[model samples]
Target: MIYDLLIVGGGVNGCAIARDAAGRGLRVLLVEQTDLAAATSSASTKLIHGGLRYLEQYEFRLVHEALAERELLLAAAPHIIRPLQFILPHEPSVRPAWLVRLGLYLYDHLARRKRIPGSRAVTLAGSAFGAPLAGAYRLGFSYYDCRVDDTRLVVLEAIDARERGAELRIGAKLVGARRDGDVWRASISGADGRIESVGARALVNASGPWVQETLTQRLDLRSTKHVRLVKGSHIVTRRLYAGDHAYLLQRPDKRIVFAIPFETDFTLIGTTDVPFSGAPGPVAIDAEETDYLLDSIRHFFRVEIGRGDVVWSYSGLRPLFDDGALKASVVTRDYAFDLARAEGAPALSVFGGKITTARRLAEHALETLAPFFPRLGPAWTAQATLPGGDLGPGGFDAFLAEVTRAKPFLPPSLARRLAGAYGTRLWRFLEQARSMDDLGEDHGCGLTEAELAFLRAEEWARSAEDVLWRRSKLGLRLDGAQQARLGRCF
Candidate 1:
């Protein structure tokens, strides 16, 4: 059977498109080269933010749309997306206090922010949030952003797409595509060297950093240049501060680094702007990038962080639109699509989108393709809840309480983690297990044999990496021996 839409990537954009299109009554199919969000989507900064820093570049429209979407996402998936407070230390040398205040004001007002709190100023000497900051920093500003389980977000979308009649194939790599009259014929090769061909009415390339590679090499499509590959890396260390609040540290070179409260016991410090010519899949944090991130965190906080403190590190390439910008940080985070139709076949190539704006991008993409499918259903995903996001009216805490009551033997920490990751859908696994024994052997950090098996069966987890790195961050809690043991199990 020919699908109405065939999405080539299973990252945020592709998953979002699949969900939207499927919800619109179109038959959809999504193919992923690796596990869902095993690449750039899983390796993001993990913030559903409007990017307050973009205000300096006068990207008001982008910031406004992103900020508006932040609240929408939080409402749609409260279990996975929640509000986070960012503490920005006032650094007069880097940016004037008044200027920062102005930017914060603009950030708060640019969008329809009903659920997230507005910005506020705090005194470093008196406020609880400033206890870990350097004594020289007397004042700070706190604003709202949203934190997301980025990998779970993608998976939820894929699940929702499947529920809405979309076929999702993981570990399926798109090898070739060509137009044949009114349809597009595509071939996908699985990891085990199994190849399959499918036909679709339209094709979508949402390959993130590999957008260009997919266009030029796989589909053999031509379009004017877009997408500048910029490498951003993150390091995970032990918790730096004592609060739920995260810090936005300003570097001496006018760059900003995030020191976020990660998991329950760790802090995630990130991100350097460097040009990347290397392959996106094998991107790793270099020694210099690690040192640079460490130095930036050490500069503002009273706590001294070094390479020894880092437990885990990851790197991902950002697909920014090339707007003749020399600096990586200055490049616009906005996205653009190249829609080309040859003979009667249509191919849509998406480039330079962030996790925050994926829904809007998908909606616009469908609108752009509406001319081809004139009989397609109208847009319907704006207010739709993603799979496992049907938390009813009480919110995440209520759902967690319900899950805990259902599975009293589950540890509080483990229950909360599962509820956050799977939302109301935790019942599927918990309902079968009567006691801790039924949960199976612990694979470190609340990850159990039962949970791993559930992931493999339901979430398409084919390898250990899919469970440890993408489905969850259990790798940080497990030692080498434990990882090896789990690897063998997989």
Candidate 2:
């Protein structure tokens, strides 16, 4: 069978494209060399945002589109993606008070905000948001974005694509491909060390950081544009504050840092923008980046944070479109595509993109290749929901109540975590379990055989890291021995 589209990479953009194209009745095959969301997608700041900081860079269109997508994504995946209020403590030194208000005003009115509330000023004194802040901070502003289980978003997109008849091959690397008349002859090396040849009408390179490498090395195509590699790193520490709201900290250098709640027991702080020239692979936070994050947070939060306080740290590279900005932070977060259809068998290479607008990016991608496939279906993902996203008319809170009532045998904590991770879909696996014993071998935390089996059979989770780290952030709770046992099960 000749697939209508062949995609490379399993990051958010790739999965989103597969989901969109497959839903449009196009036979699609998405091949990822590693696990879904194993790279930059999972290492994000974990916020589905319009990038308020981008306003300073004068990226109005990017911010507007992202803000619009923000509301749509929240509706599509209510369980994993929900509204988050952000508190930006004013540092008069950073910008004049009028400028801050003006920026906030524009952020509120740039796009039509439906579920997310408008931005407003807040007093830092004697308020919950100000409790952990330094004495110097007296005023702040609050606006809503969202928090998401980033990895699960990618997995859900891939799952949706598969359900729509898209073939997703994890642990499969594209050895190379050549344009043969009208279709692409692609060689893929599977996990079992077997090579399979397939034909596709068109090819898409959504290889996030590997976009350039895939085009040049595998397809033997020279890219008309270049992607600037920038490294962004994050650190996990014990909860820094007492509210559900996240803090946006300002640095003397004018860069911003976020301190948000994570996994119910930790604070997620991050993202240093340093130009990266090294080959894209496993990246870790360096001593300098660590110091920078700690120092930036310390200026606002009264608590003293050091290297010892970091429980877990991760780093990922952003393959942003080269916009010739002197600073990495100033580069545009928007996406672009280079279509090589003039040469035969339309080959589209994706450039810079962020999680906030990956769905829109996918829509535009299909639109770019529409001429080749005249019978392509119209765009439909905008009104559709991803797997397990429909929480009924009552939304997540009511859905949680319903699960709790139905599963009286489940521990409250376990029930809440399962509902948050899988939403209404947890019933598929939990329906047979009557009590704690029914869950089978405890892999530590609340993870049990029932959930593990579901992940392995359904979610493409191949190892403990996929289950503990990406599927759910229980790695923070598991010990070394427990992790090893869980890995062996997979």
Candidate 1 residue-wise lDDT, 102-211, digit = tens: 99999999988889999989888767787887757788999999999999899888888888899998878899989989899988897788988889999999998889
Clashing pairs in 2: none
Q: Pick the candidate with the highest TM-score.
A: 2
lDDT (CA) per prediction? 0.89, 0.92
lDDT, residue 292, model 1: 91
Residues 225-307, candidate 2, lDDT per residue (tens digit)? 99999999999999988878998887878999999999888999988999999888878899999999999888888998899
- TM for candidate 1 is 0.98
Q: RMSD per prediction, one decimal?
A: 1.3, 0.9
TM-score of each: 0.98, 0.99
Evaluated at residue 139, the lDDT of candidate 2 is 88
